[model samples]
Structures are given as structure tokens and as C-alpha cells.
Target: MHYRRFGKTNLWLSVFSLGTMRCLAGESNAEENIQHAIANGINHLETARSYGKSEPYLGNILKKLPLPREQLTITTKLPPTPDSQVMDQWIDESLERLQLDYLDCLAIHGINTWEHLTWVESPRGCMQAIQDALAEGRIRHLGFSTHAPLEVILAAIQTNLFEFINLHYYYVFQRHAPAVALANQKDMGVFIISPADKGGRLYTPPAKLVELCYPFSPLELNYRFLLSDRRITTLSVGPANPQELDAPLAVADQDGSLTPQEIEVFSRLETQAETALGTDRCSQCYQCLPCPEMINIPEVLRLRNLAVAYDMTDYGTYRYGMFENAGHWFAGVKGNRCTSCGDCLPRCPEQLDIPGLLADTHQRLNGSPRRRLWG
Candidate 1:
């Protein structure tokens, strides 16, 4: 597998790191996948307290293996439970679940707002817990994961408290490019999540997108596009199974990559997709705030974008199922939760008609019959 310098850490990390979201679902088969990944040179394993049962399953698998903990890098996150005591409890629980004495890296999960930053960075905040864990040798490094506005990310980086960062970045979602660049400048490790959602759709893309990315598989084009930037320390790939893992590993070995001409074509394709969708690309800034129903507007917009951009109605359907069946659904806003207050309109830099676009998105994905304020 291709390896890149992990910023100033001087560690060479595989471009294809294993993500544990799906692995948690297959607890019965997680060992096999973990073994497969290790055998294939995937030295980095990423999980989180928020991903159900992932840490516990991984802990069980590691306990049975003979591999030394030092040979592997383990990354996980603490959920924003808000209470510092709860954060401490979560960290200890994570360590117990992972069967490790200390975490190589631990992040404050999902910092999407300034409020989140304040809570984590305050004296009585989660950062205190993180610092205590570091002092006690329970965590080697502290960091954070975010899908916030670029300014928020920039502000976090300025604190210089983190050793690493996880963020959403890819060819299609270039919002975090500036943050990635800043991480590079600071010698901090940068991890990217969900290239497929950010970059590829399982189904065929529009002909124009395909034409724009000639000589590269949609996956390869997207991966290569991100790898072109040196700031990216690692790219996390969520493979449903072992077979799906091969493509990304192969991408690491490519020699002659997409040329400038291909890049130009890809750019045109992105523009065309935006034009055709007719919705302002959500930068996931969450500037449109206080959804009456607490629906995560950016996440919904992302799912909608995936549905249209990748043409994977089934995938979109599954994502929609998460909203319908999951208990923690829409901690931010429910689907169709907008009251059409239009308060977020003036705040949006893109000037998108939030309510109108959401209505169209709801109709396109869930059909008109299911339409309502909180459906």
C-alpha cells in the first residue's frame, strides 16, 4: 500500500486506513476483516465510541491476536456527552473496549459548532479529561473530528493542542482543503473520512462526470484527486467487505495518474452536477441554525447530494432508514423539520432558499406522500 508522511509525526501511514463503522455491524466477522487488513499492510485502525459496538468488538479481536500494540496505531473518539466526568468515563470505557492500555490517538468527536469548541476547550470541559488521560498515560495524543465551517476548523487549529484531526474532505467536498493545508503547515496529522460519499457514488454518475474523469475509475479519480494534495496524511475507506478493500489498496500503487486535462474535465463535471442539482452545495457549515425540529440540515443535504450525484437510490434509501429507525436520529433536526422560518436564509453565504430546497429534497428522496414537517 502507498504510505504518506503523517504531517510532523514523521510516521508513514497507509493511504487506506480501515474505518470501523461497518465492521461493528459484523461483529461475528470483524476478526477476519481485521486480520485481513493487517495481513494486507493496513496498520492504522480507526473507530469511535459513537459507532455502536465497534470498540468492544475490536478489543475482543485484538486480545486474541499476538500482535504487539506498538506495531499498530489505534484511533478512536469521545462522544460529546457534554459533562467532563462523562467524557472521562467514556475514555476509560473505550480503553476497556479496545483492550489497550493507552490510545495512540483520541479525538473529541463531532465538533460542528462554536459551542462544541467552547465546551471541549474550557477548563471544566472535555479537554481537561483529555489532558488527564494523557497525563495518566491512557492516551498518547489528543485531537478532534469536525464537519464544521472552515473558520471553526481554522480556529481549532490555532489552539495547537491537537496532534491529529479528522475531517470531511474529498474531490467533491473541497470545503476542508484549506484546513488540510493548514494542518500540513502546522505539521499535524490530517485524516479524511468518507471519500465515496464525498467523492464516489456506488452507482454510475452522470455521463458528464464520467467523461470528466476519463482514464480513472470513479473511485480512483476521487482518491487520486485527494492524494494529489500533500496535506492529506491518511484517507479512511469504509469497506463493507474484503473485496471492496482491494480497489483503494490498488489506488495506492498507481504510477501515471490523471493528467491536468483530466483534472479540468473533472472540474467541469462537478460544476455540471451542481448546476443540474439546482441546490447550493452545502458546505456543511451549519450556519442555517435552530431548525425547529433539530434536524441536521447539512447531513440531510449530504444524503440528498449522494442520492442525486451517485444515482444510488438504494443507498439513499438505507441512509433514510437510519433516520427512520435509529433512536438518536436527528439530534439536530428531523427530516422535513423546517418551519419555513427563513431565519437561516440571510445567514447563508450561498443564499440558498433553505425551506424550498429542503422541500424539493424531501420530495425527490421520500416521495410527496411522505412529505410533512417532521416526517
Candidate 2:
């Protein structure tokens, strides 16, 4: 696999890291899946204490695999909650579960708010456990993973206590670019989470998206687009089954730089997307933000685009239903919370009937099963 200098850590990290977020804890095939990933040159395995059964499952798998421990880098995280003692116990449990003595990195998991950030950074809080781990050589480096607002995420990276930051940034959601740029400026590693699944459901992509992402599959398009950005260090994949590893492995082995034809194709894809999404859709210009009820209007509207433009109604509905209980993770309330005050209407450059569209969004996408996945 092609490797990159992972920022200040100075590790030649493979661009595609194996993520076990979706690994069925204790499944028999888990070992084979991991072995396949390793054979394909995915040298990094990122999981979390919270990822059910993944830690212990991987631990058992590693014992049977012939790969040397030194050739692999394992990372796991602790959620910043309860108290530092709980955090310490979780770490100990994680090591026990992984069958490993020391971790390459220990991330303060789900730093999704300023309060969570404080918990990680404060002396008497989670940092105490981390400091103890560092001193004991239980973890080589400390970092954080977040789904906070760009402002809060940037603030977290600016703290400089982290050597790496795992966050989401993909072709569909470029909102975290500034945070990544800040990480690059600070020489911090940027681990992009879930490029295929969360990055617009490319695995089961709509025909329109498949067509627009011509010459390359939608999955490749998404991967190459993110890899083209110099600031990104690694893209994560969660492969429970063997086939899931193939696309990521292929992408990893290739020279990441996009060719001139691919670059031109990228431009055409944007034009094609706009055409497919239609002229009257929410442009996502951000002018319609700052909703009175703090609703994530643009995101809900993007779901609408998925339904209407890409004919991905099932996908759109699944995403919309997730906001019902995702808490701060999905952030602001869905479009159903729109107060119809026309506050965002005047700001919208598209002159969209914001209230009407909000109503339509809920009617269309919130009636189905809510599918939620972790990165």
C-alpha cells in the first residue's frame, strides 16, 4: 500500500486503515476478514472500546495470525464520560480485550462538544488517565475523534495536545476542511473516517451518482477525491466481510494522484450533480443556516436531494430518520422542527420555499426505518 508521512507522529502510515466499527463482535469470519486486510497491506487497525465486541474479536484473531506485532499499528479510543477512573478501567479492559500490552494511539473518543473537549484537556479529568497511560507506556500517543461543529472541532485541534485527529471529511461533506487545514498546520495526522458509507452511501450508490462518477466507480471517486487533498493522511474502511476489503485495498495500492482525465471527470461530475439535483433545489449555499429552531436545514435538504435528484429515497429516508435520536451527533433537529417563520427564506439565495421544502422532507424521508452506523 502507498504510505504517507502521518504528520507530527512521523509514521509512514498506510493511506487505507482498517476500521472495525461494523465488525460483528465475536463473529467467526472476523479473523479471516482481518487477515485479508493485512494481506492487502492495510497495516493500521482502528477500533474503539465502544465498538461492541470488536476489540475482543480482533484480539482473538490476532493471536492466530502469523503477522508480527511490530508491522501493525493498533488504535483504540475511550469515550470522555463518567470520570477518569472509568476511562482508566476502559483502557485496561481494552488492552485485555485486544491482547496487546501497549497501543500505538489512544483517542479521546466522541469529542462532540466543547464540554467533551474540556473533559479531555483538563488536568483532573480524562487527561489524568491519559497522562498516566503515557507515563506507563500504555499508549504511545494521544489524540481525539470528533463529530463536533467545525468551529468546535477546530478548537479541539488547536489545543495541540493531540498528535492525530480522526474526523469526517469527504466529497459530499467538505465542511471539515478548515479543521483539517489547521491539523496540517500543526503537523497533526488527519484520519478520515468512513469515506464510502458515510460519504453519501457510495456502496449502494444511486444510478445517477454512478453515472456521474464515470470511468471510476462511485467508491473510487469518493476515495480519490479525498486522497487528492494533501492534508489528509488516511482513509478508514470498516470491513466485516471479505468483499468489503477489495475496493479499499485496490484504492490503497494505486498511486493516489488523480490523472488529468480524472480531474476533468471530477469537474463534469459536479456539473452533472447540479443538473441532476435540478435548479430549484437547496444550493447548500449556507445562507439559509442559523435556523431559528437550530435545525440543520441544509443537511435535511441534502437528504431531499438524495431522494429527488438521485432517486435514492430509501437512503434519504434512512438518513432523515436517524436525526430523531442521534443527539448532538446528528446535531440540529430535522426539517420537521421548522417553525415556518420564513426567517431562513430571505437569506436563501435560491429563493426556496424553505418551509414548504421542510415539510416535504419530513413527509418523504422520516416514515421509514432509522439506520445508524458508527465510523
Best by the TM-score measure: 2
Give candidate 2's whole-model lDDT.
0.82
**Residue-wise lDDT of candidate 1 within 55-169, one digit each (tens)?**
8999888887778878788889876555789889989989988989999888877776778778877888887788889899998877788867678889898889887888888
TM-score of each: 0.78, 0.93
Candidate 1 CA-lDDT value: 0.72
For residue 178, give model 2's deviation from the true position in Å.
0.9
- Per-prediction RMSD in angstroms? 4.9, 2.0
List lDDT for all candidates, in order. 0.72, 0.82
List ranges where model 2 is wrong by over 4 Å.
Answer: 277-279, 285-287, 369-375
lDDT of 1 at 133: 90
